[model samples]
Target chain A: MNDTSTRAPATRRGKGLLPLALGMVLGALAMLVGLAEAGRLKPREPQTVVALGQLLDAEHRRVDLMLERGDMAGAIEALEALREQPWPDHEAGGDVGMQLRHDVYGRLLRLRLDHPEVLPVEPQALLRIAEEGLGESYRELDINPFTARLAALRGEVLEQLDRDDDALAAYVEALDMNSALLDRELAEEGAK
Target chain B: MGAGALLGLSACTAKAPLTAPAGGVDESAAGGDRDDASLRAADLSSLELELDRSWEELRTLEDSREPASVEAGAAGPGDVVDRCERIRGLADRICVLSDRVCALADEHPGEERYTSACGRGRDTCTQATEAADRCAAG
Candidate 1:
């Protein structure tokens, strides 16, 4: 009877050990498979910031040409395209995207100010976006010469609209800003 | 299994099916309301600013005349004539802008500020255009 009871206990222990051992082996196999799959996966490609910059530059040039041709609608269309692009987040170096958007919106605002009759919409919307996106940093960065140019263009538009006093005020403000820009350029040249 | 474990599993299973429908319905309704409010607010503000700007332009043009600094010898009759013609062109543009503002104001009835500004702008543009025409003709 003692020997039989001992055998039964050993059989029970064997059953438990078998399941535990099988589970451990399966778990290890799963981990290996996961590691292999991870190693085989391709790294995410970094976004081409330079290409985006070039695209924005081309768009700006196109907008300028359209404006010169008096094709306000075409200019507006181009600007809309630039603004609507799915820009990467700022964490992904999306400041360039924001700058491009701000520049495009600023140009659009100036265009509307110049030719309000053709725009079919108010300038405030464009102005608000430009202001919100760029803020004072626009003047500070001065990367896009277009901001100052747009300001001058806006003054011209106000003049055309016959708000001479306001136009004159705008012109004076632009001239002051331009003088500051000139000084900065001179200082940079001196430094170089 | 214990009763508690069974209850927990049931709750987890029910959560996926039951919460999804309710969440979707609530989100869609909220999104629709948000979009409508944003669009309406933007439209109203834009129209109001447009009308105000038009009126301001009209006032400026009406008040603008050759500077007292300009003697007959300093600026010839041709200069005066050119200035008058420019003024008339501006007056016409103002009139067109005023009419547009009026139409937009009518479409958005609750915007009292826009409606009043448009009415005032239209009157100002009319007066300015007439004055500019007279000056140019003279």
Candidate 2:
């Protein structure tokens, strides 16, 4: 009887300890969760910053569509609006922002040269924007394809402005760069 | 016990379950789609060359003062109609090519390389064709 009574109490006490231990664990978990909510831990990873790139791409396409419809004024308006946008503060070497800016400037310059009547700015101003927008930073990054296209557009602008010699030089430079890009792309294709 | 050790190890190594992207295509399938897109980007330089030549001729015409002398250099106003017709022909071919590339890129939507290449080519073709129409009109 005594043995049975002692063992019974001991088993009951063991059962009681389990609830206590479980409570302690749950409380600790709640506290840890609270700490996380309070941001004691490292911040969560940022949402993927892709929307800006997408918006720029869509806008570029819209400009193309407008141009296709011979809506010169509409195209100019869109291109100018795109140019006025603040360049995204993307991480260094991020190509999206660079490509977006270059595309906008290149297209704008083309529009200015092709349809000066539609452009709000002078052709010279548009040329200047292209020169500055497609600067050495893109070259430093070795984005040769875009650089080549921009150079070609610059040549066209120069030609329109009657700077034939400078235009010729720019065109030659663009041809060389494009040749290099083609070779590189072909080599990559071959490797693949 | 060995079982206890295994359980502890499993708990330590636990990870969230993998989930497919919103569109339901999993990573491997997406990679396969990119591979297909790569095929579409191949050997576009030849098309680019054709566009470049037409563009240069247009520029030459725009730059020239003496229409006759420019005609000698490029398509004369009579030749302009012919050259513009040729450009429109190329644009037709490019339209087909662009459609193929875009369709391939659609298999892996949002892949930047595919999107950019396809879009660039398509835009170039569209603009070139439109310019040719203007050249013809003039």
Candidate 3:
């Protein structure tokens, strides 16, 4: 007690501050990690629907080009190749993708119908393709021409297999849709 | 074989002048009203048959006929125009059917089936009209 010393008293100024600073830094880092995991930190992807729609349009134009050159086989091949691509499901693609899928299937089916010799598929297989392309909820959607065309193509395929009853139903479905579409067209035209 | 004799005989055998049915003016007047009613009551099944035929005809024509103008990666403008003509024809039939469907929908407001079909008809019409407009622009 009598020793001569110039040192100050030990007040423990930064005692608990170490753990607090470490906890704050760790929390910040955790938040960033979560954000990156959720992809919020990254650049956004393109509008999937619009981009896919444009892809559809471009592909159609390509098909047209092939057809213009009188290369039916090439057209069929192109469409088939498109079919092979991994299509977005109902969740990812939504209505637009489904509609585009129908368009592609329809064109391919039509080509196959017109020229059975090119990329020839049997009647049964064609029917399956038509069914698969149409899917279950296709009827729930509004009358899309591509969907209608696909329905008609389904009818054609059904006829090929001698399933006249089913074919008639398919034809009716398609015609009804187109009929509805035409009605809308006229109404709009008149309004204009 | 005498000319005068043959002429007289032909005159004797000549058909009477055709006359319009009585009330013809009123008939069309009545029919004018009936047109809308009849369209509303149009047989969807028969019209669907017609639509199917139209589609077949369109496909046949498009397939058999050569492309009038060949664009690089699409149907020619001429083809688009031609296709529109056919599309218009189809649109006409669809319009008629839409009237029928929508009219029925109005009549049976409580019927979900009719209401749904009419809504679809209207929606489809919007899309189809937009498409047809594009075709016309082309």
Best by DockQ: 3
- Residue A165 displacement in candidate 1 (angstroms): 15
Cα interface RMSD of each candidate? 32.7, 28.4, 43.0
Ranking by lDDT: 3, 2, 1
lDDT of 1 by residue, A15-76 (tens): 34553333323322222232224341111211333335446545654654565565778877
**lDDT tens readout by residue for model 1, B1-138:** 111111111111122111212222422234433343443343333323322332222222211211111211233211222445545544554454455456556656777755665676567576667766666667
User: In candidate 1, which residue ranges exceed 4 Å CA deviation?
Assistant: A1-48, A88-91, A94-98, A132-144, A147-177, A189-192, B1-138
DockQ of 1: 0.01
Candidates, DockQ: 0.01, 0.02, 0.03
lDDT of 2 by residue, B83-105 (tens): 44444544443454455446545
Q: lDDT of all the models against the reference?
A: 0.41, 0.44, 0.51
lDDT of 3 by residue, B13-81 (tens): 111001111112222223433342342222222223323333333232222222223323343421323
Residue pairs in clash, model 3: A179-B94, A183-B94, A183-B95, A184-B125
Model 2 lDDT on a 0 to 1 scale: 0.44
The C-alpha RMSD in Å for every predicted model, in order, reads 30.1, 24.6, 32.2
